[model samples]
Target: MSFIQSLKSSLKASLGSKQRQVSAVPQIAAKASENPDLEKLLVIPVSDDPKEEQQRSHAFNKGQFLARQERWEDLSKIVNDEDQNRRASGGGMPIAELLCQGARADVVALAEHLLIDGTPEEARPLSEAISALEQILGEHSNNHVIATIVAMAHLDIAWAWRGTDAVRDTPARNLEAFELHCTRACQVLDPFCGIELDSPLVTSARCALLVGTPNAQTRVADDYEDLIDLAPEQQRHIRALGHHMLPQWFGSYETLELEARRTAARTQDIWGAGAYTWTYFDAVLVDPYCARYIDIPFFLEGIRDILERSEDQHNANLFASFAAVSIPNAAHLCADDLESCSALEQIQTAAQWIMSDYLHELHPLIWGHAMEGFDNHARIASIDALFKQGREKANQVFVRIFGEQMRKGNALIFTPQGLYVQQA
Candidate 1:
């Protein structure tokens, strides 16, 4: 069978059971040559104003929401409207190419979520979204934006199948679709490699090929040098992903941190540095060998240093939040020995340090939950008013009063069942 034939067969199979036979459908071979202005529709514009930026943000977010809602028809309208508007204006594509790119990623994400949940009914929406994207790609084969989106759509289909036991049981046929889609995605991105190095879509595709599933593993680490050379700012939010992924390729903690710091210095973005550091800590927290390899105190001290070095309050808060999540898990490793002792004292010590250092940072996050109000905005504003009122009181009194107010009946408490929210 041809590529499109195989894809059609796959889509048909998704419509029902794997054993269902699919009738031959005419191959969708519509090429981009037919659409001379296709490239014009795929241009991504930079945001120069708040309104433009918000619109762009909203477009992408709405696309994601549509995908999650399984509203395939709505998604199709978005792409079509953007194409029409782009042609009419000869500029300012309604759906930014980046948003379209994200739409494909969202398709893949929703597909995986459905597969994991093991609900065949959920697959229908994914199949619909996938078919729609495929149709779009059929017409715009050479449009790199749509091509990337289509490629990722294919990758997601393959990823979903890889996780399904029915597909994996057939070794020869198992990754057939998966391999094809991954190759297609790579080929699409390979032509204009440098342009997409910073894209989360591209980064995620590369990561999927590397560490995905056993059947989906491509082990091809391409364009990483180009990635490392790009400054943190240039890398978008995805620069931290390198630090997250390189360990699987035999990179060490020190080397990864050095690369992260170098990228941070090159970009002079402290927030990126904090984000990068958090990725490493996140990895270690899941299975904290870092604490064993180095001393637990040393591991925690490094996190503290990152938090302190963060120039922006947001960055500092972000790093502290990561520490708050990671440190408690890692505390058991903090004892004089990992195998010999429980490390309860060390855990207590670490928790105390985090509480002391990050209480102010945690206050804002917990404050909303504590406040009784109509909505988030009202609650958050009420917190500000309370904080202001407290500030007028003595500093010590203010800290005690607001801290107690926020913690009362709104704190997260561990119970026999699981983590429970204390009700106000």
Candidate 2:
């Protein structure tokens, strides 16, 4: 049987009486079978009409191109126009692309105006954009794009407060607007599955509580606990190194404690699964820092451990994002001078070393995306240069770990089942 058919059979056996009722699996499998990248998996549904979807897709593509080109003003105009049309038609396209580029102040301003003044249909795109921008900013704390977006969020919030009489009449309206922005920020910055104590959202809620809102107090507590437990110790350690390396650069003790509590609450043990079947993944993104300090030995050891545990050989693929830096030097530098080399260069060198050492074993699974210091690398390098200075960089490295069973035609969605293997 095909992978999907096999998966369906397995799922049916696992679910027993409830198997007949589940319908999403087939649709998911079909989507994955058609597109190898799982692009549909990240899409947020906007409308059912084919024409609207096409227009929105075109607009999104244009917006992305404009962003890459640094043509912020033109990008803003196109998105605003598409958003307006979407409002008039009562349907729209996904706003992810627009939000991804809306880190510009003018873009955010235009989007905000459309959201507040346009039809009810505009609400969804606005909210999605707000949420996405907030999330991106939170994750890359020191990114200029993030700072710009946060500034815009604040500006829009201020404008809302000033433009309305709700501050005096219906305080809840103003509070809701502010809360949405903060919540988006929190969601973005918190680890994909971990609790976050330093989230601006949590902090804002606390402030609001001191000023009144008894219900928010309970929500704040619940959110805190949920964020903490999203990931356990090993995942946190592995992921944390991606943020910063030096112990001194890490967040304070209280922050770490809160995170630990939240993490403990969210973690689930999957060790009971006998031998995990292998599945291939399309990509594995890695932060430069992770490639630098943790990935090498950790990955090697992991491979060895998996082999020893399973006894039978299983193969999986890997993808990594890194910079290619060429330095002209003989082995004549002192230890302190070597340490002073650009962190980006060090990360690149380490990645090269790791790739070289594991080339024979990992060649099939390993593919590299070079960042000529223009894309994410530049932003991360800039962050490291400005704030931490060899401490930590404000950039994320995406890593996709494939299962041995995953095939080119197999559908892979970011659902609970896929996430289990992805996280592993």
Candidate 3:
């Protein structure tokens, strides 16, 4: 059988005995191409040039392979090496962080399936895999690296049990399982929280664990403060804090504004006002009501600050993805709240300058999420559609922004190093 057919069959079989066909996520909506400008320029597509994605995936790939092979010691060595000395890839991302994330791929996939399908897998497959890691941890009780991995696995299992809908959407039984795993994740990770055992993964895990705690609202800022300080360069943590600051998660609009500014002040040396920009980046998109709370001038300045500080293509692509896909998409998601809608429009207009000035290369996976409203979890049916969605989004944006140049037969070719004009 063909790979897609085999995949579909196996996935269907894994959904338990309900007999209703199910998938990891909902089906992708067919978007008809309507832009006459879409054909104006030649584009460097994500699937066609996967080297950028591969650069980020190598650590995750290596880590998962070792894990599936039961090469626990080898995995431990990679973690330890990174823990002792954090290493950055050519794109300036911390390799150890990706390794830590990839280590839990097995359990995370199960949890993700549960989150998207809204059905419980009967065999409790993640339990068996987690137990193996726990056994390995028992043999090396002092290995905080393995403990971090174990803690992360429990966290993934916890989220799977809870699922990704509103609290009201989940059944009581699922909530019970979620709490049980979350509490265990907290306990397992307790030892690594000590002063001497300081690590970014541990800090991040703690920030995530706040969701399970009763005091998430009160402690969210403090936990994130420690994390951003510990890893100043990782603006993702700052981005997360903004989402958490929303009233639905941990804080109100007032609190979000305060925290964004406070974070900007604290990380000024590293991110400048860029910290404030990152903090508000996802907030407006995730919670449109929070848009008015953002400082418009400061936010734009930070966008410039971020690109000015880094020549690496990865950072550039981040803003590019946001400008090309995220803000434009956010504008359509607005139903009411004219004030919030107006704020999103402002950002959307600003996105043009980003496509024109800063964006040099593209990252397909990043753009994929950007195209799909930045919901990292599944919503699209086909796994392959992720990159395809990004390419289409990028093409549409390029055509609109560079239509004049393209109409004159100048095609823009993007590379990891720079953008080139191909004379036609």
Model 3 lDDT per residue over 349-423, tens place:
666666556666566666767765667654564546666666666666676666677778787766544456778
* Of 1 and 2, the candidate ranking higher by lDDT: 1
lDDT of 1: 0.42
Per-model clash counts, in order, read 0, 21, 0
TM-score of 2: 0.25
Q: Which candidate number would show the highest lDDT if scored against the true structure?
A: 3
Which pairs clash (backbone N, Cα, C closer than 3 Å) in model 3?
Answer: none
Model 1 C-alpha lDDT per residue in residues 69-123, reported as the tens digit of each score: 5455566556555533332111122343445645655556556555654466656
Candidate 2: tens digits of C-alpha lDDT, residues 147-207: 4335435444443433422125545665676655555443433332222322322222232
Query: What lDDT does candidate 2 reach at residue 393?
Result: 15
> Which of candidates 1 and 3 is the stronger one according to lDDT?
3
For model 1 the local lDDT of residue 292 reads: 37
* Candidate 2: RMSD to truth: 21.7
Q: Point to the candidate with the largest TM-score.
A: 3
The lDDT per prediction is 0.42, 0.31, 0.70
Off by over 4 Å in 3: 1-52, 88-93, 111-121, 165-168, 379-383, 404-424
Ranking by TM-score: 3, 1, 2
